[model samples]
Target: MSDLPPPPRLPVTFRPGHTRAILLTAGVVIFLVISGIAMLLEHLGPGSRLSFILTGALIFWALAQLARVKVVADESGVTVVNIAGKRRLAWAEIVRVNLRPGDPWVFLDLSDGTSLPALGIQPGIAKQRAIADARALRALAEAHSASSALPHEPRS
Candidate 1:
């Protein structure tokens, strides 16, 4: 038998910062507040259908951006949240995890021969120490896999 290590297990409980969601949400809030004040002042009367419609649209868009993203792990496998939503995959189901520093996002390498969409790990998040943070997460995933006893043997 060949000696090999198993894949890493994702963090059982993890939540990525929803920066896009938050920003969009804040914009909606501010717009509504201003609109309300304008209407109260009679500056924006009831006939201001355009302003009302615009405000409603912004609120809806914010809600859409507010996606619940999380990564969960267990003895069985790991679950990932992508554009399609959350999906649970076993360790064997996970082909690889390629977390390269590009486009300010983290992409996952899957087993079925598909690349998972990038999750904004560093979306608009610029800092002198962001590199360190990104590396740490990659290391954590590697360590988790190592600790989980996931096999690393080549298939023939």
Candidate 2:
């Protein structure tokens, strides 16, 4: 059987493209509609109007968090940015990348025996893309750890 191609070059980033697009798009539409309704309500007082606008802003902010989730891989390590926080993990620290069936997103099994949720690679709207990204990341981690294990020859 033919071997799979090497992982993509470093400095690569994986994100849920469709998820982000939908979230941001929906946020904008919801915000606009909410703000418009607030302004159109002639009976509402200024305080209520401002509160309505603020509510819209808050909703947009919340959605922005999910839309910003991403996984970035560079020479040093991989950075996972989720809805609430970000974490950096060296290639050697990542023992495995898993995307099992019915999983909401990729999960990274670490050398420390911890499993981290990689929300950046969700199988929503694009299952194939998520699978490809997870495999590529797994390959990169394996390749990096293997290279690091090799003993270097002494300089002449």
Candidate 3:
């Protein structure tokens, strides 16, 4: 009776497409502007120009990190790659998937007493897409966990 779409096939990846594109574009633009300004500043010494270019490169690297956020689901488990860290979880380890209103991204409640933030499915420029992604992920987790659980025991 649920209206949500079926879970995606294994080896699926969920990511904020628009956010990645925008971040990449912004990074390139910022790097170009900084390099251009450095080149145009004839009065600046060579060291200063190099510093400016290096700064631009560093900025681009940081932005690229954010753009790389994603969640990959395979037969083994799900891998969540955030800005600074990546964590892998077995399907049975995920107790629930949450993307409540006003949340920036999806959060996974683990069987352990911990909640993991999944930045890959963020409600940035594409809110609806993020919701769909979250739902799909949830469905995948539920399906996989249910099949893996022993029939004699209840799922926690």
lDDT of every model, 2 decimals? 0.54, 0.93, 0.94
Q: What 10-residue stretch in candidate 2 is worst by lDDT?
A: 1-10
Using Cα atoms with residue i matched to residue i, what is each candidate's TM-score against the true structure? 0.56, 0.95, 0.93
lDDT of 3 by residue, 1-156 (tens): 346678898999999999999999999999999999999999999999999999999999999999999999999999999999999999989999999999999999999989999999999799999999999999898888878974876689
Worst 10 residues of 3 by lDDT: 1-10
**Candidate 3: Cα lDDT at 24:** 96
- Residue pairs clashing in model 1 are 5-150, 5-151, 5-152, 6-150, 6-151, 7-150, 8-145
Q: How many residue pairs clash in each candidate at the backbone level?
A: 7, 0, 0
Tens digit of lDDT per residue, candidate 2, span 1-156? 215459899899999999999999999998999999999999999999999999999999999988999999999999999999999999989988899999999999999999999999999899999999998988888888888889999999
Q: Comparing candidate 2 with candidate 3, which one achieves the higher TM-score? A: 2
lDDT preference between candidates 1 and 3, better one: 3
- What clash pairs does model 3 have? none
lDDT of 2 at 128: 96
Question: What would you estimate as the lDDT of candidate 3?
Answer: 0.94
Model 2 root-mean-square deviation: 1.7
